[model samples]
Target: LDSVLVTLEEVTVCFSVEEWALLEEWQRELHREVTAATEQLLASLGRWNLWGLLDMGKILGGSGF
Candidate 1:
């Protein structure tokens, strides 16, 4: 995983200024979408009392980033 991240960073470093800016913008948008989805999921879980139905440990433990 570390190696992959290093490779990705190297590739990103090769991008032109405009391309880097666009990539940064896209990443920000993706982060916002993920945050919104997480908020909605939490709200639904709270409303439905589904907390015990899901495993929070496994869900939050992975470093997928």
Candidate 2:
């Protein structure tokens, strides 16, 4: 994640107010996609190993985080 952020910092982005609003929408979309992905991953793991997946779900704060 640190490496990804470092790469991001080197990238330049320019946004007007409208563009910023669009960017915010895109961020929310990405967040939802990420949440869905994590949930899928947790569900898949839970099916194979419920106990370990339960611990991982705790560390990930389940759906709250």
Candidate 3:
């Protein structure tokens, strides 16, 4: 995993300025979509009491769903 991350970093560093800007723009868009979706799901879970069913301790411990 560490090696893969390093390789990805190196490759990203080689991108032209325009390419990098585009990549960053795409990443921001993806982040926005993901955050919106997560919020919507959490809201639904709350309505159904499913969010309360989850273990708070596990979530705080970084155990992602």
Candidate 4:
């Protein structure tokens, strides 16, 4: 019974670790997509010379990669 409990605990820990890793990977991918979209939007806005129409400082809020 003790061995069985130990084995179950080990499996649970392994499963949790794997789940955490998967979530981290998903977060990284999401960040990448958001960054790409932001860059593209910024480029388009720049090309149109419409930067003055929006408050970029408030939008970015100093949060960077």
Return the lDDT, model 2, position 8. 20
lDDT tens digits, residue span 1-65, model 4: 35322222332112233443455666646654664565566567553233422333234342222
Compared with the true structure, the alpha-carbon lDDT of candidate 4 equals: 0.40
Pick out the ten consecutive residues of candidate 3 with the lowest summed lDDT. Answer: 4-13
Q: Go through the candidates in order and give the C-alpha RMSD of each one to the true structure.
A: 14.6, 11.8, 14.6, 19.9
- Candidate 3: regions farther than 4 A off: 1-23, 47-65
Residue-by-residue lDDT tens digits, candidate 2, 1-65? 35322322232232344544555656746654664565566567553333543454465444321
- What C-alpha lDDT do the candidate models reach, one value each? 0.40, 0.45, 0.41, 0.40
lDDT tens digits by residue: candidate 3, 1-65: 35322222332223333443556666746644654465466567553233432433244342221
Supply candidate 2's per-residue lDDT for 33.
Answer: 64
List model 1 lDDT by residue over 1-65, tens digit each.
35322222332113333443556666746744654465466566553233422332234332111
Looking at model 3, residue 52 earns an lDDT score of 38
- Model 2 poorest ten-residue lDDT run: 3-12
- Of 3 and 4, the candidate ahead on lDDT is 3
Candidate 2 structure, TM-score to reference: 0.36
Each candidate structure's TM-score, on Cα atoms with residue i matched to residue i, is 0.36, 0.36, 0.36, 0.36
Question: Over 4 Å off in model 4, which ranges?
Answer: 1-23, 47-65
Residue pairs with backbone atoms closer than 3 Å in model 2 (clashes): none
